[model samples]
Target: MSPWNWSDLHLRDPWWLTAWLVVGYLGLRALRRRPGAAVFYSEVSLLRLLPRTAAQRVGRLLPWLRVLALALVVLALSRPRAGQEEFRIRRQGIAILMCLDRSGSMETPMSLGDTQMTRLDAVRHAFRLFVTGGGPLGGRPDDLLGLVTFTGYAEARCPLTLDHHALLELLDGVQVARRPPGLGGPLRPASPSGLTAGGGGELPEASIPSDPYWAEERLTAIGDAIVAAVDRLKDAPAKSRVIILFSDGEQTAGVVTPAEAAQAAKNLGIRIYTIGIEPNQATLREIAEITGGRAFTAADPQALQDVYREIDQLEKNPTEGRLYTQYRELYGYALWPAVGLIVLELVLSSTRFRTLP
Candidate 1:
């Protein structure tokens, strides 16, 4: 909620107010210094003989009444106005696309106090804290969330939607696996041990391979992931769109380079915030500069979580909001009061208040 006003009621026009004071001073001087000349000499005894009634009292007050009327008229002429305005904000929930690197490199184990957790695991924890728990920091729950996962290729795991629970569910299901076969026979099994000849006796349960392809895949197509997220948000409503890219300092395979993808997002009016888990300053700088967003290097899970929380803070409260206001002087007739004061002064001098010659 916000408020605006055109003219502040508390503010006064110094120039006009000064003029009023000057007029009052002049009136006082004329009454005190030339009281004999300003009023015609007459006898109050004549009025006392004529009548003793309410009219005589009313007549006596005319001079003071005129002075008060003149003061009010001066006040009105100053163009005093009190204005108030209010805003009716339509809360347009934000549209956010979270691009996560799912390359095998993301599996590197990092120490969590005495315990060790993979990069992917730490990200999941932070992500959970952001969604179901609250903002990765303390962001509002009403913001829309989307998801993108990339390894050798990029995939839109979730579209822009307000269903954060569903989005988190999709994120939780993410896992590092070999890139799907590219225009070839059925995806090659992750291991040869999984293949066995069918036998009259059911082949011994395909023995699990001892070597589970622990080496991180050689490709991380971060650029493609950003491009995909941007494309998905193209048709979104005219609200601020943001992309939070989480990666471990690598981009080996993609049709577009990271710079090109950042340009595309910039052209589409989307802000990209890059969070690099790796300690590569050069790479982090490039990503941050290209996307016109800040670069954050997280050496550990706590830092990583903090980065996400900061982004949430930025999201909930935008830098600026709409404003509109108007101001008008209600009425302007200060001269009327001055005129009334003159009339009262005249009547008082001609009647009961007149002095004896």
Candidate 2:
């Protein structure tokens, strides 16, 4: 059998201890009393004459036995319990606000085997993996999630909520461009595939360069997005709040700088984790360092998935402690048993072991 463990074992009332002490003192006094001359006996003769029955033997020991049994009954009344009662514990879960760059640059087609997939497509795939229970992200149904998207201007796509299904659906519905034209940049064509001609000459496939005119509108507003996300989570009640920013490292449009936004988050006790979809280590490192968070570079879909998985682990296993408490009440008809034991002792003493005159 397994050993029993109890959270609480001490007596709740110190008066009960004093009462037990008094009872013990009285018992000792009773045992030490001298018999009167009228009740005195040369006991061997009388004891031999008595019937050798089990009831008689029990009667002889009844006084001390009754006292011991009463003590046990009183101790039971003190209500010893092996475990604590159930309580409603409030275990605070992590709050995460995902800030994704939806600038026109995200539409650039990256190769996936023979096919092509946009950066946005890769990001959405990673997000889907994160929201579904327990792979890399370790996201539980209980964790609160929020969403933000940024192009020229940052906007809250969804508020903080524990509704995972709704959040996933919202994420799926997010398209490349939700705002009007000329906001971020014009979509560029796929990169050309280099080929060798019959005469050893290089043949370049048709390709379109990203529009350079909207440099400010298309790339620079990431700081604004971070600031907006931080503002949204400022009054949140969770024990730990986090911001996961996904960007392509080109920042050209917002009023605030990434460093300033990171300072704002630090002031509000929010940690930021920046994931750069392209190979931009310098930008990623700056964002990570400024906000005291981690930076990950995802050059491919699998690497992006790994980054999200790491975020999930960080969320599930936070660096905080928790305390818990419990209580219980027990009730029964104790009066009857106490009275019955007293009466039984009295009857056995008078009838079964009565003294002769």
Candidate 3:
């Protein structure tokens, strides 16, 4: 909203509006001035009895027509214009990629101030609020957002997109890694004859869990996740490209180290904001500093949401939103009408409204 937007009539030359006083004074004089008598007679009682013709009725309005023309001319001189409308031309927004850890540690029970849930669930909730807007947080409607999840390996869950609904839907499906029962924990193998290895005794039964997909889900790969996010954001067509890395553990499995990935992002003019969930902050802080971003530690779900809010404040739209007003010149409208009225006054005064001096 701007000052000029307050009114629809924009006067380019407001000083000309003062001419209205002169026009009014001249109109008053014209109204008060009497025309000289065209003819004089000894007796004039017959003239009062004569019927008033249409020309005579029109003739009385001639002075008023002159005054109206002068008013229109004054309006034209003021250079009145119509404020068409106010609008804003918004520029492109920032591009952000969020990398989240899905390792077994993320499944630890956590409280979100009001309710208790897994750490992964709390992260999802906070992310939803950050994207869709909630109490104290404005949504990232103008930004292009993407997601990456990592454990032993990194996976690109979604590409950069403006459709937040789809992005959130994908985020809802991310879950903590569940290890297979027979694979990870302690295991006791019985002999082929159903006897203990040490002696001829009944072999203790072993409870073997039945899932194989947990191996990759049990280890954290912070560096690999950052590299994957950098790949997604390096070519993004935004002035400001950012990567938000969230992890509960240090880099446990990845070909490239976190520092190397951070250096790569810095080379491409990208920032990486690291958020640690009850983990050592030294590596996270180093990564953030390398990429010219910040590091945050979330002790609880509320603190995690607060970290996201702070990031939201830090990354505003790259382009500023500005309001502009466009005005359509209206002086032509007044000027033409003024000219027509003047011509009409001239014709009428020279003919039907004419009086002898």
Candidate 4:
């Protein structure tokens, strides 16, 4: 319920208020006639001289009580709500589409503090922190974020939205791409010993191919990922549009070359910040350069988290929007009163105001 003021009060179903006309008509008709006048009295001058009893005086109120009850019922039918508050919000926000590589090569183990996890798992953890805010990252509260996963093909896992919780849920479900059973190669680990450390330790720089079947599983479609991101980010309404390309391998499968996709992104005023999980950064550096963005190589889990935090700082825009809370339902305020009045009317009509047929 709200104070009876125009600014705070809102009628949800105003059409129901039209029922008041019927109640009003009934009230006027009730006022015109005596309600319990079933028998006529003739030659009764002596009866008029007698003092009226308490029951007869109080009985006059029954018709009005019923009318009041009906009026309350009509009021209840017209649902009422109250506004809490409203304000204008101004924030520096950006739209970011994170392009993640899910190829089998991403199964390479990496160190995260005292625990060991797959490269994809490390990236997922960093991304969750980046969106929700933890440690050094302030989180993207006002920014629109999306997701794109790629192996041999690129797929948009989530659309650009302010709902980061839903985006993170989809991100959690992403797994390394797997080939069919009859495929020539198995998902062999890139490094059996796991060449990564947490506190700025030396990371594996060279792509040492120990398994002959490695090439069959490592189908990273970097170009297709960029193109997919561009398609999703081009029409964003934010002041700044960005794509974070996170991958451990070069472009091994795709129709469009990485250079062409970068050029397309540049034409559409979209920046692509490339982060290489592996040390080979030639293609990533070129892609960043073509789109007037930056590239970084994350040797370990900490480095990957740092890269995302830096990107959050680099892309900033001042955005204006209105914030309004949903209205509070006030129907119960009217509805309960209407029910009470109805019960009271029934009890009085049945006892003190009882009439003959």
Instruction: State the C-alpha lDDT per candidate.
Output: 0.69, 0.69, 0.83, 0.82
lDDT tens digits, residues 247-296, model 2? Answer: 88455566887888888998888999999866654765777788788988
lDDT of 3 by residue, 1-357 (tens): 333433687789999989999999998998899777678889989998999999888887888888998898889989987675556767677999999988777878898657899888888988999999999998899889999999878999999999999999999998877655445454332232444435566743442323424534555678888889999998998999999998877766678899999999999999999999755678899999999999999978999999999999999875666777677777888889888988999997887677887
Candidate rank order under TM-score: 3, 4, 2, 1
Q: Number of backbone collisions per candidate, in order?
A: 4, 8, 2, 0
Candidate 3 lowest-lDDT run of ten = 187-196
TM-score of each: 0.53, 0.56, 0.64, 0.58
Best by lDDT: 3
Name the runs in model 2 displaced over 4 angstroms.
Answer: 1-77, 80-92, 108-118, 140-143, 178-220, 313-316, 319-330, 333-357
lDDT for 224 in candidate 2 is: 90
Whole-structure CA lDDT of model 2: 0.69
- Write candidate 1's Cα lDDT for 59-95 as tens digits: 5465566667767676776777655554545456778
Misplaced by over 4 Å in model 1 are 1-90, 133-136, 178-217, 318-357
Q: By TM-score, how accurate is candidate 1?
A: 0.53
Q: Give the TM-score of candidate 3.
A: 0.64
